[model samples]
Target: MDTANTMIRYVSPINPASFPSLSILLLAIGIFFMSWFIVYEVTSNRFTRNLKKELLVSFFASLFLGFGVLFLVLWVGLYV
Candidate 1:
Protein backbone atom coordinates (compact mmCIF):
# COMPACT_ATOMS: atom_id res chain seq x y z
CA MET A 1 0.00 0.00 0.00
CA ASP A 2 2.91 2.36 0.65
CA THR A 3 4.19 1.78 -2.89
CA ALA A 4 0.73 2.60 -4.30
CA ASN A 5 0.59 5.83 -2.32
CA THR A 6 4.02 6.92 -3.59
CA MET A 7 3.09 6.03 -7.16
CA ILE A 8 -0.03 8.15 -6.93
CA ARG A 9 1.89 11.07 -5.50
CA TYR A 10 4.51 10.84 -8.23
CA VAL A 11 1.91 10.94 -10.98
CA SER A 12 1.76 14.26 -12.76
CA PRO A 13 -1.16 16.02 -14.34
CA ILE A 14 -1.01 16.92 -18.05
CA ASN A 15 -2.51 20.12 -19.39
CA PRO A 16 -2.80 20.72 -23.13
CA ALA A 17 -2.37 24.49 -22.98
CA SER A 18 0.51 24.46 -20.53
CA PHE A 19 3.03 24.97 -23.31
CA PRO A 20 2.17 27.39 -26.06
CA SER A 21 4.01 27.26 -29.38
CA LEU A 22 6.55 29.80 -30.63
CA SER A 23 4.03 30.98 -33.20
CA ILE A 24 1.88 32.42 -30.48
CA LEU A 25 4.81 34.43 -29.19
CA LEU A 26 5.54 35.67 -32.66
CA LEU A 27 1.93 36.65 -33.21
CA ALA A 28 1.84 38.51 -29.93
CA ILE A 29 5.01 40.35 -30.83
CA GLY A 30 3.51 41.29 -34.16
CA ILE A 31 0.41 42.61 -32.49
CA PHE A 32 2.42 44.77 -30.12
CA PHE A 33 4.66 46.20 -32.83
CA MET A 34 1.78 46.87 -35.11
CA SER A 35 -0.10 48.63 -32.38
CA TRP A 36 2.84 50.85 -31.57
CA PHE A 37 3.74 51.46 -35.18
CA ILE A 38 0.20 52.40 -36.06
CA VAL A 39 -0.08 54.94 -33.30
CA TYR A 40 3.42 56.26 -33.92
CA GLU A 41 2.91 56.59 -37.63
CA VAL A 42 -0.20 58.62 -37.12
CA THR A 43 1.25 60.90 -34.48
CA SER A 44 4.53 61.48 -36.31
CA ASN A 45 2.80 62.47 -39.49
CA ARG A 46 0.29 64.59 -37.68
CA PHE A 47 2.58 66.58 -35.35
CA THR A 48 6.31 66.06 -35.82
CA ARG A 49 8.43 66.91 -38.84
CA ASN A 50 11.45 64.58 -38.35
CA LEU A 51 9.17 61.82 -37.00
CA LYS A 52 11.56 60.81 -34.15
CA LYS A 53 13.59 58.69 -36.60
CA GLU A 54 13.90 55.76 -34.21
CA LEU A 55 12.95 52.42 -35.68
CA LEU A 56 15.07 50.46 -33.23
CA VAL A 57 13.57 52.23 -30.25
CA SER A 58 10.08 51.62 -31.50
CA PHE A 59 10.93 47.99 -32.15
CA PHE A 60 12.11 47.50 -28.58
CA ALA A 61 9.05 49.24 -27.17
CA SER A 62 6.85 47.04 -29.32
CA LEU A 63 8.68 43.97 -28.14
CA PHE A 64 8.18 44.92 -24.51
CA LEU A 65 4.51 45.62 -24.97
CA GLY A 66 4.05 42.53 -27.07
CA PHE A 67 5.71 40.13 -24.64
CA GLY A 68 3.99 41.66 -21.63
CA VAL A 69 0.57 41.50 -23.21
CA LEU A 70 1.19 37.99 -24.45
CA PHE A 71 2.26 36.77 -21.04
CA LEU A 72 -0.71 38.36 -19.32
CA VAL A 73 -3.15 37.01 -21.84
CA LEU A 74 -1.66 33.55 -21.73
CA TRP A 75 -1.60 33.48 -17.96
CA VAL A 76 -5.19 34.61 -17.67
CA GLY A 77 -6.32 32.29 -20.42
CA LEU A 78 -4.69 29.33 -18.76
CA TYR A 79 -5.76 30.06 -15.20
CA VAL A 80 -9.12 31.77 -15.65
Candidate 2:
Protein backbone atom coordinates (compact mmCIF):
# COMPACT_ATOMS: atom_id res chain seq x y z
CA MET A 1 0.00 0.00 0.00
CA ASP A 2 1.51 3.29 -1.16
CA THR A 3 0.64 6.09 1.26
CA ALA A 4 1.40 8.77 -1.33
CA ASN A 5 -0.95 7.26 -3.92
CA THR A 6 -3.69 6.69 -1.34
CA MET A 7 -3.51 10.26 -0.08
CA ILE A 8 -3.48 11.63 -3.64
CA ARG A 9 -6.80 10.01 -4.55
CA TYR A 10 -9.33 12.82 -5.06
CA VAL A 11 -12.79 13.23 -3.63
CA SER A 12 -15.18 16.01 -4.67
CA PRO A 13 -17.35 17.80 -2.13
CA ILE A 14 -19.70 18.97 -4.83
CA ASN A 15 -21.89 16.38 -6.55
CA PRO A 16 -23.94 17.70 -9.46
CA ALA A 17 -26.73 15.21 -8.98
CA SER A 18 -27.35 16.44 -5.46
CA PHE A 19 -27.29 20.15 -6.38
CA PRO A 20 -30.58 22.02 -6.57
CA SER A 21 -31.09 22.75 -10.27
CA LEU A 22 -34.04 25.07 -9.63
CA SER A 23 -32.07 27.21 -7.21
CA ILE A 24 -29.32 27.71 -9.74
CA LEU A 25 -31.84 28.76 -12.36
CA LEU A 26 -33.54 31.12 -9.93
CA LEU A 27 -30.24 32.60 -8.88
CA ALA A 28 -29.28 33.33 -12.49
CA ILE A 29 -32.66 34.79 -13.32
CA GLY A 30 -32.77 36.83 -10.16
CA ILE A 31 -29.38 38.28 -10.83
CA PHE A 32 -30.34 39.23 -14.36
CA PHE A 33 -33.61 40.87 -13.38
CA MET A 34 -32.21 42.68 -10.37
CA SER A 35 -29.33 44.03 -12.38
CA TRP A 36 -31.53 45.01 -15.30
CA PHE A 37 -34.07 46.70 -13.10
CA ILE A 38 -31.50 48.73 -11.24
CA VAL A 39 -29.82 49.78 -14.44
CA TYR A 40 -33.05 50.73 -16.13
CA GLU A 41 -34.27 52.68 -13.16
CA VAL A 42 -31.03 54.56 -12.75
CA THR A 43 -30.71 55.45 -16.42
CA SER A 44 -34.35 56.01 -17.13
CA ASN A 45 -34.38 59.45 -15.52
CA ARG A 46 -31.09 60.66 -16.94
CA PHE A 47 -30.69 61.85 -20.50
CA THR A 48 -27.93 59.76 -22.02
CA ARG A 49 -26.37 60.62 -25.31
CA ASN A 50 -26.33 56.93 -26.15
CA LEU A 51 -29.02 55.05 -24.29
CA LYS A 52 -28.18 51.66 -25.74
CA LYS A 53 -24.52 51.92 -24.86
CA GLU A 54 -25.28 53.08 -21.35
CA LEU A 55 -27.70 50.23 -20.69
CA LEU A 56 -25.30 47.64 -22.09
CA VAL A 57 -22.46 48.85 -19.92
CA SER A 58 -24.65 48.90 -16.85
CA PHE A 59 -25.90 45.37 -17.49
CA PHE A 60 -22.46 43.85 -17.88
CA ALA A 61 -21.07 45.73 -14.92
CA SER A 62 -23.82 44.47 -12.68
CA LEU A 63 -23.49 40.95 -14.05
CA PHE A 64 -19.75 40.75 -13.48
CA LEU A 65 -20.12 42.26 -10.02
CA GLY A 66 -22.74 39.71 -9.07
CA PHE A 67 -20.64 36.85 -10.41
CA GLY A 68 -17.61 38.15 -8.58
CA VAL A 69 -19.50 38.20 -5.30
CA LEU A 70 -20.93 34.74 -5.93
CA PHE A 71 -17.48 33.37 -6.71
CA LEU A 72 -16.02 34.79 -3.52
CA VAL A 73 -18.84 33.36 -1.44
CA LEU A 74 -18.56 29.93 -3.05
CA TRP A 75 -14.79 29.88 -2.61
CA VAL A 76 -15.12 30.70 1.06
CA GLY A 77 -17.86 28.10 1.47
CA LEU A 78 -15.66 25.33 0.03
CA TYR A 79 -12.91 26.03 2.53
CA VAL A 80 -15.03 26.85 5.56
Candidate 3:
Protein backbone atom coordinates (compact mmCIF):
# COMPACT_ATOMS: atom_id res chain seq x y z
CA MET A 1 0.00 0.00 0.00
CA ASP A 2 1.15 3.54 -0.75
CA THR A 3 0.10 6.76 0.99
CA ALA A 4 0.06 10.24 -0.58
CA ASN A 5 1.57 13.16 1.25
CA THR A 6 0.48 16.74 0.74
CA MET A 7 1.77 20.03 2.05
CA ILE A 8 -0.48 22.90 3.07
CA ARG A 9 0.45 26.59 2.90
CA TYR A 10 -1.03 29.49 4.77
CA VAL A 11 -1.48 32.88 3.23
CA SER A 12 -2.13 36.08 5.15
CA PRO A 13 -4.58 38.77 4.13
CA ILE A 14 -3.88 42.50 4.12
CA ASN A 15 -4.34 44.22 7.49
CA PRO A 16 -6.12 47.52 7.14
CA ALA A 17 -5.09 48.52 10.64
CA SER A 18 -1.50 48.67 9.48
CA PHE A 19 -2.08 51.47 6.98
CA PRO A 20 -5.08 53.54 7.95
CA SER A 21 -3.47 56.70 6.60
CA LEU A 22 -3.08 55.19 3.13
CA SER A 23 -6.75 54.26 3.07
CA ILE A 24 -7.82 57.77 4.05
CA LEU A 25 -5.46 59.37 1.56
CA LEU A 26 -6.69 57.24 -1.30
CA LEU A 27 -10.30 57.97 -0.42
CA ALA A 28 -9.71 61.73 -0.30
CA ILE A 29 -7.79 61.85 -3.56
CA GLY A 30 -10.39 59.72 -5.28
CA ILE A 31 -13.23 61.93 -4.11
CA PHE A 32 -11.41 65.12 -5.17
CA PHE A 33 -10.61 63.81 -8.64
CA MET A 34 -14.13 62.49 -9.14
CA SER A 35 -15.61 65.83 -8.15
CA TRP A 36 -13.26 67.69 -10.48
CA PHE A 37 -14.11 65.38 -13.35
CA ILE A 38 -17.81 65.87 -12.79
CA VAL A 39 -17.45 69.65 -12.68
CA TYR A 40 -15.37 69.64 -15.84
CA GLU A 41 -17.90 67.55 -17.64
CA VAL A 42 -20.67 69.87 -16.63
CA THR A 43 -18.91 73.16 -17.44
CA SER A 44 -16.96 72.26 -20.56
CA ASN A 45 -18.31 73.18 -23.96
CA ARG A 46 -19.31 70.21 -26.10
CA PHE A 47 -18.16 71.98 -29.30
CA THR A 48 -14.68 72.61 -27.85
CA ARG A 49 -13.96 69.25 -26.36
CA ASN A 50 -10.41 68.23 -25.42
CA LEU A 51 -10.49 64.48 -25.73
CA LYS A 52 -7.03 63.99 -24.29
CA LYS A 53 -7.62 66.02 -21.16
CA GLU A 54 -11.06 64.62 -20.63
CA LEU A 55 -9.84 61.08 -20.99
CA LEU A 56 -6.94 61.65 -18.64
CA VAL A 57 -9.14 63.16 -15.93
CA SER A 58 -11.78 60.50 -16.26
CA PHE A 59 -9.19 57.73 -16.14
CA PHE A 60 -7.56 59.02 -12.98
CA ALA A 61 -10.92 59.59 -11.38
CA SER A 62 -12.12 56.04 -12.01
CA LEU A 63 -8.81 54.46 -11.10
CA PHE A 64 -8.50 56.28 -7.80
CA LEU A 65 -12.17 55.91 -7.02
CA GLY A 66 -12.02 52.17 -7.57
CA PHE A 67 -8.93 51.66 -5.46
CA GLY A 68 -10.23 53.97 -2.77
CA VAL A 69 -13.48 52.11 -2.44
CA LEU A 70 -11.70 48.80 -2.40
CA PHE A 71 -9.36 49.91 0.33
CA LEU A 72 -12.22 51.34 2.34
CA VAL A 73 -14.16 48.13 2.07
CA LEU A 74 -11.18 46.14 3.24
CA TRP A 75 -10.50 48.58 6.02
CA VAL A 76 -14.02 48.09 7.32
CA GLY A 77 -13.35 44.41 7.96
CA LEU A 78 -15.64 43.27 5.19
CA TYR A 79 -13.71 40.70 3.23
CA VAL A 80 -15.01 40.15 -0.27
Candidate 4:
Protein backbone atom coordinates (compact mmCIF):
# COMPACT_ATOMS: atom_id res chain seq x y z
CA MET A 1 0.00 0.00 0.00
CA ASP A 2 2.81 2.46 0.86
CA THR A 3 4.69 1.63 -2.33
CA ALA A 4 1.59 2.17 -4.43
CA ASN A 5 1.00 5.54 -2.78
CA THR A 6 4.59 6.64 -3.44
CA MET A 7 4.38 5.61 -7.08
CA ILE A 8 1.21 7.61 -7.61
CA ARG A 9 2.65 10.61 -5.82
CA TYR A 10 5.74 10.63 -8.01
CA VAL A 11 3.74 12.00 -10.93
CA SER A 12 3.50 15.72 -11.39
CA PRO A 13 1.67 18.01 -13.83
CA ILE A 14 3.59 19.82 -16.55
CA ASN A 15 3.96 23.58 -16.71
CA PRO A 16 2.14 25.37 -19.52
CA ALA A 17 5.12 27.49 -20.58
CA SER A 18 7.22 24.35 -21.01
CA PHE A 19 4.67 22.93 -23.43
CA PRO A 20 6.06 24.54 -26.61
CA SER A 21 9.56 23.16 -26.28
CA LEU A 22 8.39 19.75 -25.10
CA SER A 23 5.80 19.51 -27.87
CA ILE A 24 8.33 20.50 -30.54
CA LEU A 25 10.88 18.00 -29.28
CA LEU A 26 8.39 15.15 -29.15
CA LEU A 27 6.92 16.01 -32.56
CA ALA A 28 10.31 16.23 -34.20
CA ILE A 29 11.49 12.94 -32.69
CA GLY A 30 8.28 11.22 -33.77
CA ILE A 31 8.54 12.62 -37.28
CA PHE A 32 12.18 11.61 -37.51
CA PHE A 33 11.44 8.00 -36.57
CA MET A 34 8.36 7.82 -38.81
CA SER A 35 10.20 9.27 -41.80
CA TRP A 36 13.11 6.89 -41.20
CA PHE A 37 10.75 3.94 -41.08
CA ILE A 38 9.07 4.95 -44.33
CA VAL A 39 12.37 5.44 -46.07
CA TYR A 40 13.62 2.06 -44.84
CA GLU A 41 10.46 0.31 -45.96
CA VAL A 42 10.61 1.89 -49.43
CA THR A 43 14.23 0.88 -49.76
CA SER A 44 13.10 -2.75 -49.95
CA ASN A 45 12.68 -2.22 -53.70
CA ARG A 46 15.51 -3.95 -55.60
CA PHE A 47 16.02 -0.91 -57.82
CA THR A 48 16.69 1.40 -54.89
CA ARG A 49 20.15 1.83 -53.41
CA ASN A 50 21.86 4.50 -51.28
CA LEU A 51 20.03 3.70 -48.06
CA LYS A 52 22.25 6.03 -46.03
CA LYS A 53 21.49 8.99 -48.28
CA GLU A 54 17.79 8.28 -48.09
CA LEU A 55 17.87 8.08 -44.29
CA LEU A 56 19.85 11.29 -44.01
CA VAL A 57 17.50 13.08 -46.34
CA SER A 58 14.47 11.95 -44.39
CA PHE A 59 16.07 12.98 -41.08
CA PHE A 60 16.85 16.53 -42.15
CA ALA A 61 13.57 16.87 -44.00
CA SER A 62 11.55 15.89 -40.95
CA LEU A 63 13.62 18.08 -38.66
CA PHE A 64 13.07 21.15 -40.83
CA LEU A 65 9.43 20.34 -41.46
CA GLY A 66 8.69 19.93 -37.75
CA PHE A 67 10.41 23.18 -36.75
CA GLY A 68 8.86 25.00 -39.70
CA VAL A 69 5.34 24.06 -38.69
CA LEU A 70 6.06 24.85 -35.05
CA PHE A 71 7.24 28.36 -35.87
CA LEU A 72 4.38 28.86 -38.30
CA VAL A 73 1.86 28.07 -35.62
CA LEU A 74 3.60 30.32 -33.11
CA TRP A 75 3.63 33.18 -35.62
CA VAL A 76 -0.02 32.70 -36.46
CA GLY A 77 -0.95 32.48 -32.81
CA LEU A 78 0.74 35.80 -32.17
CA TYR A 79 -1.42 37.61 -34.72
CA VAL A 80 -4.69 35.82 -34.00
**Each model's lDDT:** 0.58, 0.58, 0.77, 0.63
Predicted candidate 2 versus true structure: per-residue lDDT over 1-80, tens digit per residue: 87886686666566534334533554566577667667667766665446676567567666655654554455445432
Give lDDT tens digits, candidate 1, residues 1-80.
56766664433253435426543665567676677676767676544634355576477666766655555565566442
Error of 2 at 47 (Å): 6.8
TM-score of 3: 0.71
Candidate ranking under TM-score, highest first, comes to: 3, 4, 2, 1
- Clashes (backbone N, CA, C under 3 Å), per candidate, total 0, 0, 0, 0
The predicted structure with the larger TM-score, 2 or 4, is 4
Predicted structure 1, TM vs. truth? 0.36
- Report the Cα lDDT for residue 64, model 4: 66
lDDT of 3 at 10: 52
Residue runs of model 3 more than 4 Å from their true location after superposition: 1-15
Clashing pairs in 1: none
lDDT of 2 at 23: 38
Off by over 4 Å in 4: 1-12, 45-80
